[model samples]
Target chain A: MHPEPSRSLPEKAAPSLTGWGGSPAGPTTLLRPEKMRDFKPGESPQIARGMGRGYGDAAICGEGHTVLTERLDRMLSFDDETGVLRAEAGVSLADILTTFVPRGWFLPVTPGTKFCSLGGCLAADVHGKNHHVDGAFSQHVTSARIIPADGAERIISPDKNSDLFWATAGGMGLTGFITEVSLKLKKIETSWMAVKHTPTKDLDQTLDFLAIDDAENPYSVAWIDCLATGEKLGRSVVMNGRHAAIGEIPLRENNKLDGSFSKQKPMPFYLPSFVLNKFTVKAFNSLFNLRQGSRGEFVTKFDPYFYPLDGIKNWGRMYGKKGFVQHQCVLPHESARDGLRAILELVTESGRASFLAVLKKFGPEGRGMLSFPTGGYTLALDFANKPGLDEFHDRLDGIVLNAGGRVYLVKDSRMKADSLPYMYPRLDEFRKVLRQYDPSGKFASDLSRRLNIAGD
Target chain B: MPGIEGTALVLGATSPMARWTAYALARQGWDISLAGRDVQELRRIAADLILRTGATVSVREFQAEDLESHEGFWEDCVDQMEDLRCVVCAFGFMGSQDAQNEAPALAQQVMTINYTAAGTILMHAAKHFEEQKTGWIVGISSVAGERGRASNYVYGSAKAGFTQLLSGLRARLSKSGVSVLTVKPGFVDTAMTFGKDGVFLVADPKDVGGQIVEAMTKRKDVVYIPGFWRLIMFIIRSVPEKVFKKMKF
Candidate 1:
């Protein structure tokens, strides 16, 4: 039987936990502060971080002083004319999208999920659909207010403290704490997206389409069926898009809210574990494939196709008791097919079920030395945790390293210690920068330790 | 012939309470198909069930997140539980809230496992049970869900949502002759409660299992594993927000 891990919390204490998932933990004498001045690393918290989005454990405070940034959310400045925005580190992308998407502007970059704080985005140097054209969040980042390890606050950027700037860009909040940030935003003509959808018959067809379309579309992605093997191994649907022209904008009330304003109800509880068996998945996949059949040039709003998941609040609750692990990796184009094939084969042979599998064509390298994209094909799959999950992940990790690919830090929960260096060649360079700011190694996290990102 | 003698499909058959409840009912003469993530573990447990109850049993690998495989999983297990009578859902997670709070990825893991994944399968089971018109569904809930508490509140809140969903299912299926029972247990001594200390008057897993079986047989609306947890939770819920906010659980 799969053993469910449980632990007790200190009695009579109010527990305060903050993560992107809003997960509850045991009681602790911890507090979350919304204001930057309220946090005195020496007095209230030993360390401060913004937006706990690190997948495994990097942002978590281990039985120590923890500062949460949920309440620290405030947009300080935004130049609508120039598309320049400045905000507290705790400001979330969702907040920004809701406030600014319709104002003929867009974020420089965004991850798959838009729930991250601006500071968290800077800390991870996050990239997105436009990574090929725009680069990482750090490229757009102009300046930041940092609280160094020496307990001093200063504004650092590429021109000033360039050394600390690069380190803090994707430093996982180790170099120093980011209180606020200044960054450039992209200008858009309309809130609608001009999207083109192409359906492929198999894995090979999907890869060929990606290779050909990579040069044509700035944003290109394919959703594959991992369960299909042989001829239909990589059968998928390719979705390529760009911002819609003002003339192409659909007529809707409050176009600023975009077509994504509607909220989808949440699936309230754990489904009895049996509903997700092979038969159900196959039927779902077949129905999905059939439903996605060729629908010529469709003028659609951005929300349904681009952010179908965003509609459902707390959609992750569907995975049930043992949480799921999303394994996403980017392999060089040379090894893309083999790398993806090996991973999918392992999962299917092992009977691992994945509901969502996303395949995207990444462009050039971004600002962060360790950022995931690098002009390669990236594949992401959601693995529901079950027995032998650790072993299964270990096997996948081996495939990743062998292909000279690395798992995305934001989505990974299980990767071996040795795999980090192979994934990112600039590990030592980034390490040196982190050490200069956090010499004592006072700032750390479980993800940093697991992946050996932060050195002692 | 009475109460589905062919074979009972136990959905989360690997859980502590699920196993006990399955055994309790299987001993009373129902053949069992124990399905969960680790079929090897189910195999190991299946042998013991065969030895003790001398009833036919089978084990299958079923994952809630693997939405791609659910149809085949059901097909394979359907013949074994041909006229399935009952399904017990005891799969859940209270992952280190600390771990979840530290990682948005981790919190998504907990939320998915505790709510979405479980909800998906429960909905599937409800559909099948409705068609059969003679099956029963019993799920393990917690008193912590009666109201969101600061400690384990993420899990508690998820459970609260689950309790409400099951309650609605019970109401909807009452006419269909299918019974959906919500089993809300308070402080059951199992692996799930391993680390917590000073838990007041916790009941044993076996006792909770027995109560669930009794409730299922009697077709009770909603049951508190120990009965008193219901009254205790009622009092806890009655506390005014002004006073409750000041006083910690």
Candidate 2:
């Protein structure tokens, strides 16, 4: 039977916890902070978690405790004119949008889902479709307050405590517990997205479409059809979007506040795993391509444009009881095309039908020590964690390493420790920073131990 | 279910359940007056609520044993928050009966905080809401009061009186557009019970707080948190006194 998360608190131990992909359960003691005043870190090591949306163990502290930040959610202040906000790290993007959307403000850059917390976004230095324009999430952050191993709250910013600031940006909470964040917000005229879909015949055309400067939109993503092989390899639907201007929306409507959105319907139970096998997925991909090939420019709500899967609550459960492993990698622009094609071919050749695949172009890398983006093309694919898939993923990792690409830690649950230093050339620099900040290794986590990141 | 704009007063604000309730209502756009003994922590909670939801939150000086201080708070607080719509009382004392038996001062303090202090302050709150005729009073009592065991009946009996006060107030103020709710939370995980052994089916404070907030909004009365506690307490209360007296919880 699949593990059911009990609502009990004190009575619970060894709770089955997983990220969005829902694989590799970590044995952990759960702790929730009720008050921030006189808030101090316990003697034991810990990792702060909000909603646990990081796909893997980045938020899990295995042997140590996983501090639940749900109760810590609090939005502190906002500047109407400047579009700047300061909030507790536990505050979720959804909470921000619910309050700010009507007031004409949006997140600077958001990942695929709005369920993630500001701290989760910060620790991962997450990016979105606009990465080619805006950098990672940390770029817009002005400052933050963190409690280190000593339990002393210290304010870190780009200018003030520059060293600690840069180290904590993508230090993955190795620096300490981030208590608060001061961030600049993006102003939007309306919550509607004016989108254009350009269907490409092959991988080359997809890259060409993304490279077109004049036609480039502020937000861009491509849906890759991995089932198509040979000449039709990487056949994609390139979709670009920008916030809709005031005049572009229909007259006499509260476009800013009342962007049309449907009530989400939850998937009540798990569908069997075989439903996602090759034959069915191939049929779905062909139909998806055929339908998407003809879609032209249209105005849609930001909810659907930015988060399509959010329309179906618990959509991740569609992969069934075994859960899914999302393999996301980025190769520099120089080798992105060849590397992406090979990765897709590897999956198709292995006879595994991936339910979802996405491709995006990233801008220059940020100051984050472990930020996932480079000036590259990022490709994300999901494989249901069935038998033989673990070995298949190992082989896939080898391909990524050879091409000088690195898998995203937020999405990675299985990657060899040896591959880390090779993927990130500045590993030594980050290790030094980690040593300086966390002398006792007080911020131990399953991901850090697995990849030999800060726990080294 | 209510307007996103309004104000609330959360007494015993330092409790994990109360803190969660305050944040929950604030997120729904309610201004809150955080009343508790911890001035520093209460101020922090106030600042947090303000920052998190842009709600007007104030830290009011409160003492549970001081009955005189609870007398004149109603009109003063209502004036401070322009449109006060709800008042949630999440205050109590859970002292062991053994300690109370050895020291009458402990018994008096337990009775004072759990029932006397609550009733004294709530008398003013009930009047204020009744006169304004538009809000609710949430009283956080415990399920331990439902069927007092030998281990801790002094604390349970105090809560029982507190629960009855809310019921009477509910009946008295039903027509005045005022709601009185009694919440019976079962085994919550908080700082108070952090390391207590043999704790089973413990409720998450956030969940319990959320349930309290929802009940206040939906106008539910005499509710049991985590819902299952109703059945559990019902079974405990059903036992014959002689048989129940011999057994230990």
TM-score for each predicted model, relative to the true structure = 0.61, 0.88
**Clashes by residue pair, model 2:** A75-B51, A75-B52, A76-B51
Across residues A384-412, which tens digit of lDDT does each residue of candidate 2 receive? 88999879999988888988988898998
Give one digit per residue, the lDDT tens place, for model 1 in A1-456. 223433232222335443333333323343454235544344322344455555544566555555566545556566767777777777788777766775667777777667688888888787776666666789899898888767788788889888788778877777777887888888877777777778899777888877774544566678777777777887887877777776776676667336245567777786655667555776777676666646534656655655667677666666665556778888888888898888878867887777778887777776566666777888888766667888988898888888888888766666877888888888888889767766766666546766778755
At residue A293, give the lDDT of candidate 2: 69
Which number leads on DockQ? 2
Residue A148's lDDT in candidate 1: 72
* DockQ of all candidate complexes: 0.03, 0.31
Write candidate 1's Cα lDDT for B1-249 as tens digits: 354565667776766677678777877787788888767557645754654455777787778556667667666666555667677777777776667677656666566666776676778778887887767888777787788766677888788888888998898788889889898898876545533655778786667777888888888989998999889888999999888777766
List where candidate 2 sits over 4 angstroms from the true fold.
A1-12, A214-216, A259-261, B1-7, B14-31, B39-55, B65-86, B93-112, B124-136, B149-155, B168-179, B185-236, B242-249
Error of 2 at B209 (Å): 6.6
